[model samples]
Target: MAECVACKQSSMAQYTIHNVRFFDFNPKAIHCMSYDDATSRLALSRTNGDIEIWNCWSRPFMQLFLPGDNDSSVEAMVWCQGRLFSAGLHGFLLEHNLASREVTLRTPITGGPTWCLALSKDKKKLAAGTERGYVCIFDVVDSGVMYDRALEKQEGRILHIAWHISGDYIVTGSVNCVRVWSLKEGRVARCGLGAADRKDEVIVWCVGILDDMTLVSGDSSGRVCFWNAELGTVTHSVHTHKADILALTVCPDQKSVYVAGVDPTIVQVSRVETGTKKGKVEMWVKGIQRSIHTHDVRALVVTATDRVYSGGVDTILTLSYFPPRTVCKFPALPPLGSISVAREAESLLLQYSDHVELWRLGASSKKGGKSGTFLPVTKDRVKLLELQGKDDEVIQWCAVSPKARWIAYLVQGSLRIYHFTPPASGKQPRVQRVKEVSQEIKKSHQMLWLSEGKLVSAAVTGAIQVINVSGSKAELEKELTLSPGHSVLQMTCDLEGKMLAVVDSKNIITIFDIEKETISVLPGHSSPCTAVGIHPLTKEVVAVYADMSIKEYDPSKQCYTAFCRQHLNEPSSELAKKHSVILRVSFDPDRPDLILLHNESAFVVVQKDKMAADVSQEKAPKVKKVTSGSSPGKGAKAGIGAKFSVIRRPNQVLLFSQMKGEAVVSVELNPLQVMDRLPSPLKVKKYGGT
Candidate 1:
């Protein structure tokens, strides 16, 4: 626990918290990562071939997640011209369509089982280093990949590949040497690595290139070796690690380099200038280093966001800054918005790469328990149904109807609807798939269920389509136009599902009327809105932005509504400024004036009753930061007041739901649980140590 803070909720002391720590979030190790500076987006692949595109601006948000199946795997990935390209042991070159959220192309690799991928400086040529020691180059044109040529075959597998700034040469690391391949002359030079006595001691695992034709290689010998590839000579070699090096990333400035490996520590090597100004001696010097990961790091990337990110078998994504304020860890929980709650049925729908699980929440006899103790179960939680997609399909969106009778999900532009009935006593729940869903509603961005068996979908055509889902059929009812050429990213509705609030990609927030077929575009913000929620009591929309700013808009009046004029001052608070992108904003039905906002870590509770009023001019409200719980709890809506308390979750929160019970559900990913399933970690047994 962190600390205790003052809260505005007088009833929070009695609130029942269903801290669910049993949900199995089987996270896979990160295998590769690629970053796009233009979009500030990072694309990473897991051991299961699942790929997630994270918006790595103010926060690393999992904007898009593409799940993988049993036969899929990814070893390397590259982002080229706003598109994502990945390769793996499957021997296929995959180019994914971000708009369609699917694999648009899968070209087989002739080199067999690609181990790495690199893009040319011009972003026109794509290269894949494969198991058969062949470098295959392809042409990337207009969102497509076309095979071009394969370089002369070498002796060993190409484990890593990197391109020169001029795009004239490609550098590859293999079994015991690093080779530089000239586009015209094939393999121009090679620098052998490792000691003569050890065969596989110097396995080159990762490689990079400098502008001056200098080749950098990280190998199994725990060394960061610099090679003059043009002349096949070793320029310098530094043993920066005590174990094998696995990942290396060059800073944008090219003056600094970050390398990490089995030692689990990130080492910063900088180009330092020594001696006098007239005769300066430049060398790469070992600078300050930080140890964040507890296991080997396989993927490392440094972005202009001033944050260096690394991930590996530990399944934790760590972000560290240079001077170090605090190291933030994005736990390997299913993407934040992936858990959908069915309040009426007291159930939850958890989204995975290839499947969706519907679990009926359990109840305890008591309301609250000790901080570290588990409550006695009155009713056992049940996994009602696990709906899995086909081999060729990847689940994109999933939702459970408010009543939990209808479960709908989208897989690669194909929609599937299921009718579910919660079991009675010991009876099994009935699950039936609707075969006659409307064909026209297949290509939608997001889908949610409203009241009266009405399903609303945000179509790719920038229209909200209403569908009537009956016992075994679903039909399109009406299509209301939203913002043209813009896609809706998130959608929320009131308890009755009457008032719909949606935030689009263009940073616009719009309220759509279902029965009236009308649209009210709220005065939107300039920054990207991360979440939007409607207060069930007041029907007011609360929008949270990337900069940690909050706004409340009234749809009926088409105007901004706020008690305190200093509401914008919330982001200026030290607590709010440190938070990540606000993923969700929830309103308590009983306390509509209280808005509950949370990102990846902390929960901000705002109460309007104690709002700071501007008698002459509004002053900034007082801020409270707490790690430990005192009398306060997690049930707060949005408000601007002196009781603006930020409650930081002690562990990485997985899912928090407000259901029918007087309880708050807290699910967290326990690292020990994951470690139990993994093999024994590599360890040096200190005398008598466990």
Candidate 2:
């Protein structure tokens, strides 16, 4: 028995990705990544304006997802102090607090999209490079900007920025040269140009500071150049890659630099001391034969003395270790429409473009012949249930019950509910179709489970339907009708499941009292409403409109008491304009004062009362005042102070957010807190379940 158990344990450890606890939607390219040694967290920015934070040391590997600007791509990200600062194509800088899980807009940069960012060692200075050949510097304190400075322009777009460890100098790489700026003097301290004889001028894409007086830069011509920053002269240059060098990370000892770019290869450059010259060191390339990445490497970080992490277009995070040189890789989930975790069952519910699949983890055993012994084995992924349909039948939305017994999914404007039961022994779980309801509405946009046997669905036709599933067959219990020409765009329910808030095509908000069978419309928006959310504890309804306006409705008064408006300037590109509509509005589950407002170009979080004071008319609503406390009889607000949200993004973006907060029922999940605290495999009994 001991031998069999040991063999099984060995096989599981060898095949499983123990370090990779959480995975996001696959296929979306990773644009940038940063590692904070202090927090032991890895932050990744993807092409779809989604940010993912992973705690490397946490058990079950905690992950957090912060939603980005709708349709906007994140250009750069960096971790400094206790905050994650990110820049995107919208030209705004975002500061995300690791502790509070709150995001705030720092400032907007001029010239154009900020491509690269760097923070000084003292955490007081920040430097950003813009696409229009300008470098901007800011005095940062507690993730807020104190002052700003725009340095002199160079020849081309600034691609990369690196600050000196001493906090006095910054090096920026641009089209044809590398320039070092002195923050104390606010001027160019030194500049090094590329070779003038070459036919094509080299574009500097990445820069790394080796020391206070030394700088290393990589260019499009694949040349790595070492320069003496104090003297403004190149000391050595070597060809490193086949094409542009996109990322570079310097070792903690300052002895070697790891480089990766357009090519799949990762090369290490070390400065070797020469015996003949006492003060001179020659640069040599130590190449790794195995390709660690399948696509262009866009980001690199040195996590420790011997460990490095790299991610890129391939959507894979690779960990490379030195000395003996070992590598481990983690791949994201295959590009899916949506993903949800059934925490109690240790199962993953995934929605693909054409099908829905439930994956479960369980223990299996194999008999060792002639020994009369059974070896305990573990199945990493077992497809317990799969639901597939025709190509045109796409799943629009899905929801799982709290007990993991009922699953509801919407396909082609119809709703389907299934009852799931795990097998008694080693058979596949049975997924029995319990209910199917067809609707004549144009499109069913959203669905939510009010209870295990009850569901509420909203359609674009301004109709809301309540279905009951407790009687073996699904039946339409209540159908609520709205005013003509008003199409429901977004809908949300209160924590108690008694009040439903709906945003309509005409920019109106309708609050429905489920128990009383009454509806009230709150008047205050100028443009069409896009998203709506209800506060769990206070029963406040917040709505966002296409004109970038936010309003909070007081349920007791049936009026808008507070409002906030976001003033977005004219868009720079056609793509930006196409996605300019307001996408979502939500309140922080823990803090009712904090509200998240998202548009196509940016995600802005503001304090509700403060925002009201800033942009709203406090006396606009003439209604009776009511106490802002939790009510007594209404099922004690189901998810009070629970960290979650319902704002939906693209498939990949939503999946990333769901994976981070797998244990919570929120629109957005906080990475700092999650409920997936499964015991370590080593602590489980030999034949026990995961």
Candidate 3:
């Protein structure tokens, strides 16, 4: 309900778009990360103690999450023998259970406030560096991590630690110097970093060990130094960054080293063999550098296959491939939006990590401004309800009923429902928990509310649960179990919740009739279905495939609509499929022939009108026409192919919801606004520039 930009679109009801630009969903910064090559899984810990398990096989999909405590924080994380472990300033080692999405074991370290965590090459021991300047070692046992002993104490805090592959020595980076400890003899071999002067102490943030026993360290002085572990002398050093280097990683081939930090650039150092006066000498030199981030990069990892994964204070996960020069930026946001809107009541539900809030949509200026102008606000948004979660579990999904009479949210494996009564004039609203939910409903992974007071949910096994909720009672109505092997990839429902469309992993579309308790399959397609929607008026199910082709199904007729057949067979429609992956499909109630499909980047409004079924202009307002041809050689003409218009906006849309009065609201967050809230990035002096 923040002050939004109001845009008037030419369509059947002259719809207005509430381009909301005040959605505040700031993600936490990444502190550290670890990768397991065996399973291709990544364990990333945020500034908060929360840990996220990401599947890195084909893509970075966040599979499981372990919520953190209020007073806790994670400083470092490491993966050990397929087991995920984290240590933080809380001074305890944590073992996470992926199945339960919780911490299974917590063992305190011998020293105070662990600052760094490193796994040994043998995968049998873990070393924890502490703020008290001690390196504590632990044995990885079947029971859990058990404290073994502590290394010799140093003067400064142990900011970083790295274990050599030989297991005979370990390297530690501290305030003013880097030290190499001989584990076999239990003593320090190297005691200095060759600092020109000790007046201004340099803070070492990260260190790594290469296969050739070269100690790599990045410090506050913007230097990447390679040290000879045995001689404790610097071999080569380079000023690769403008600020402190917070992260460093060595490739498995021992040929490339990546260093990044406050400067937000990843500088690659490659091993080069130079023919010197004496003989061929192996040397390290700075190579290609990519400015991939906008803020400090705190974590970097190079997998066995040479894939680079990096994250930092900007809350962005970047995947990089060197030779191909391929870099993809993945936002840290979850799949679904944390915000939901109640169309009828005009109320918004905001979901946070530990709580949920209900806010009233504000009023806009009667005289709307231009498309991009910030319309004047008539009323400020007001807060109505704040419901704290029962426990410290991340709220996966939350929704408010169409009329704002109910609210449902999923936390962990539990689905909680509450009766939300809108506030009357001069009176406060009320929220009461609707208890005794069916066990099947509690296990649901997603939830939706129909206008007629019915709740639809999908379980982990792709099963459907329909529950009748009213006042303070929730009764199980029906449960439809899907086939054992089919996994649901996308799900959607109509206004009345009668038609539920589910797309499986195999690109099959299944429509369920909630009232009749029946199911039907639509004609299959070659490309996979990316999104689906149920028409509110005509009750036709719409499916959009990976190739950007679309289809309309008559659920009642159990066949494809004639209009859909034409769209699929037309060769001119190839332009529709070449955009980004469409994630959501929104229908226009007034113009049933038009559908709005959107990804995170842009909106696509596809007008699928049959040549014979075209409505007269007197009956409905004419839609804005697109004159551009779909393809290069195709001529622009009406009633020839599927005509679609693409609208690219400036902000990223977090939520898009349809209302009753032919109006739609798109909650967007500005990129500049997001950066304004982040910690100030390093400002480097340019050559003759402001």
Prediction 2 global C-alpha lDDT: 0.61
Clashing pairs in 2: 64-671, 644-666, 644-667, 645-666, 645-667, 645-668, 646-667
- How would you order the candidates by lDDT, starting with the best? 3, 1, 2
**Tens digits of per-residue lDDT for model 2, 1-690:** 001211111111111111112332234667898888886778987776667775554211224445443445688888777577888677878787532233556588866788999888877777889988778887777537764888877667888999888887889998788999887887888988877888888888899886646899988988788898888788888787778889988888888888888875788888876655566656555555347776788888886655777888776677777667667665443321255545346455666545777765443354332211223445444666778866556564567654457787766556777888866677867777874444433245467766567778765455788877764577778888878766554466765678898765454688998889988888754455556777766888777554444566787877666342241122212112222333445443555566554442223344444434544442223222121111110111111111111122211122211111111111222222221221121121336665
Model 3, residue pairs in steric clash = 548-577
Candidate 2 regions with alpha-carbon error over 4 angstroms: 1-26, 58-62, 97-102, 277-290, 334-337, 340-398, 402-690
Q: What number of backbone clashes does candidate 2 have, counting pairs of residues 3 or more apart or in separate chains?
A: 7
User: Per-prediction TM-score, please?
Assistant: 0.88, 0.51, 0.77
Pick out the ten consecutive residues of candidate 3 with the lowest summed lDDT: 630-639
Superior by TM-score: candidate 1 or candidate 3? 1
Q: Given candidate 3, what's the lDDT at residue 511?
A: 90
Model 3 accuracy (lDDT, Cα): 0.75
